[model samples]
Target: MDQNFSIVSLVLGASTVVQFVLALLMAVSLASWTVIFRKYFAIKSARLKTNDFEQEFWSGTSLNDLYQAAINSARQGSPLQRIFASGMREFLKLRERHLDSTTLVDGSRRAMRAAFQREMDAIEANLSFLASVASVSPYVGLFGTVWGIMHAFVGLSNLQQVTLATVAPGIAEALVATAIGLFAAIPAVIAYNFFARDIDRLSIRFDSFTEEFSNILQRQVAPHPGQGAAAPSAGPSTRPMGAH
Candidate 1:
């Protein structure tokens, strides 16, 4: 048989339900691939940007200068930058008020936590859909295959004798549903898993940066040599936000 009368013809000639199932699977597979490509780039970019920011942060540059740059790039800053900006901004505001070290730390922590949640939410967008496609696509394809086989056997009941030629086309068409289902599911599953792992690592990095920033502030909060003897007086909290 020519190529046109093979699987292509089988699919084209499939029952209405089987054809619908195949069409649905193809659509899902296409959509899943789109998400896979998009998410691959997005998560990778986020990780790379986070690494670059972390390097810049610990390079002993002045905090105020970094904070200023962060503010300027606020629109395009990575998750790390956003979290730092939120904490540092709150720290600066509280310090200007002459709040005690403990209160300053608390406010800064709150600010960073809020910012962290927002960034994480952005990173996690659409992951659930990928997961859904991965988990459900196979079953959907199996449903199509089963329906196709039933359809073939239904036709067989009308024949006087079953032959390979009579049975092959129906089974072949039925199997296409499963093939398309696997095609849709496998990439989605792989991409979803890859993103989950990468995102998790990024999450850990964000957490570590937050804690380290808080510690730097905590050090500034402590009294200087012999200053503990006198009452604590605050003036911009020793410039952790401005890191002289």
Candidate 2:
């Protein structure tokens, strides 16, 4: 019994197809774990960076100063920073042309939306692979199980008598493939769900920031009651502290 029960022996005794299936599952398990770890760190870093940048953004920093800083260190800025930068750049460009306020705001909004899509694309990279692994592994394992059991029954046709010893090992080894599949799948499924939720939250936050930021820019584009064309151009220095 001890001899028959060894995992290595069971695997070794498995048919070529079953062995291939087991190996495939193992490989998928390894890849899934690798993705899970990488995604974990990536999401954590994004969240932390977003939080830090948001704090700075609402801390009464002038948009011009913040935009300058963000542009200078753009690589380190969060998604929000990128969105702001895109919108600000467009807004500034339109303002330079002395475009109508409506056109300026529309162009800025369009630029921000485009930036938002790009940032989301970057953030969600490789997530589909994780999702595919999670969704497909279970069915793959079941296929292995079916193949192994069918093979086991076929082998019994050669025997005059059947016993637990004859069937248990074959069935056990076949089930191993299923277990390995589940092993590969569960964490991937969990991580995919967790990441999806987090990403959704981040998207919402980014969208909210976009709306608020748009309003601030709108105020700048709109002329103040007392100030006419003589008022200094609404640069970063002119941003209202409370608008953020």
Per-residue lDDT for 186-213 in model 2, tens only?
9989999999999999999889888877
List model 1 lDDT by residue over 52-103, tens digit each. Answer: 8877777666677778889999768788998999998999898888878888
lDDT of each: 0.84, 0.83
Query: What is candidate 2's local distance difference test score?
Result: 0.83
Local lDDT at 194 for model 1: 91
CA displacement after TM-score superposition, residue 65 of candidate 2 (Å):
1.3
Give the residue spans of candidate 2 off by over 4 A. 226-244
